[model samples]
Target: MTTPPFAPVTDADLAVLSEQLGRPVRGVVGVAARCVCGNPTVVATSPRLPDGSPFPTFYYLTHPAATAAMSVLEADHVMRELSDELASDEEVAAQYARAHEAYLRDRAGFGDVEEIAGISAGGMPTRVKCLHALAGHALAAGPGVNPIGDRALAMSTWSPERCACAQPGGAG
Candidate 1:
């Protein structure tokens, strides 16, 4: 399995993340994906946070524009369409299952959290849910790894190739 590419987190990155999230980030292992402007788009968080909380959503989407676009897609009920596609298409289901395994493998690199041992974010391997998490995985894992995430990114108005970050050049 190909491990996802991520850069080591810096204090500057943490500040930018705090600004983007409107709160300080906890247990962020690395910057999973970046915007065209070099701002963090997705963050690879630890399975367990500093507060002893078991956080299962490892690939957390932090870019405001990307997150907003995903929220719009969810509001439009695009999830149902994707869910139907998953239900009807055998290839999609297979790909989604693989995506789930990939997610588990990626998270296992960090310490294991028993509370979320087998769980992956976004209702993976079964149903479509939370485009944000799926898109995060897509951005971090790169194209062709997560079909549903790729589809969600394709459908969304946001594009990683273009800079939509509020803070240009990842200014904190």
Candidate 2:
């Protein structure tokens, strides 16, 4: 048996996630990572929804600041630069491949989905498409797992080293 790489979700987590997303959170299996203040920074989700839909995103970034930073980077066209880096740099490309494997391993706990087999979100291994997905994988697996995610985090104004959360009832 393999140990899972995430923390279990709690009722408090569900509440905070609802606030972070401005909607109710669902299908979360675990708290993949946390803010320094213990907010749900990333969540591990089910591959198949209760409604029988296939959701490929296993590691989901939930913190508003992190998502906002990724949004800013995307608006700046960073994906193109990262994709070019993947094409030009062998070491980076290799690291991304490892990240893809890590993603698959992490997602395997939710069982398998045929439609998304061998497919991890954010264009892993050969491309850099979505910073949200890459950053989710990075935060969940920590810094060195995804090169693109690490780069994106470093490039962004938000830093995971701190707690930038506004918890429910102002506990933050």
Candidate 3:
């Protein structure tokens, strides 16, 4: 049986994402370009939050094939490179604990513990989980504060149709 091909994000979808971000997307560029493997990467920069401050934020969306390839490549890279260091069960548990704690603390400003637990406990969907893992690796390799792997960015996807960032209405 043939597996259905993944759908690519279209220019119209990119335009929608740019619109939701409230800025003219600067086209595929830089780290966004790297993550998308040269696929068209849409970027909206310095988006403001009503009251202006240097938002210092960007939104990146890639073609679906590139997105999928990135996921696989990142996973393979981690497995081959970090497997020895992460081999022990104790080490794996410790890493999970650290990552989970970081996730909780980073999200704590939002509200109650129960709500936060509920949200995270729901289990991230497969694609999102992979992207989040990849983002973590990307950040660890970078300099400075390395904010790229945070839950907000990690949870984003190239599927503009399903992306809240690409669509209007409701706070995500």
Question: How many residue pairs clash per model?
Answer: 0, 0, 0
Model 2 alpha-carbon drift over 4 Å, by segment: 1-3, 169-172
Higher-scoring candidate on lDDT, 1 or 3: 1
Q: What is candidate 3's lDDT per residue for 57-157, written digit by digit as tens?
A: 23233333334534654555533333333344454435444544443333333233342352331122112234434343233223222222333233444
Q: How many clashes in candidate 1?
A: 0
Which 10 consecutive residues of model 1 have the lowest summed lDDT?
163-172
Tell me the tens digit of each residue's lDDT in model 2 across 41-110.
9988898878878888998998988999999999999999999999999999999999998888778778
Off by over 4 Å in 3: 1-69, 74-87, 113-172
Best by TM-score: 1
In order, the Cα lDDT scores of the candidates are 0.91, 0.88, 0.35
What is candidate 1's lDDT per residue for 10-45, written digit by digit as tens?
888888899889999999999999987788899999
RMSD of each: 1.9, 1.5, 14.5
TM-score winner, 1 or 2: 1
lDDT of 2: 0.88
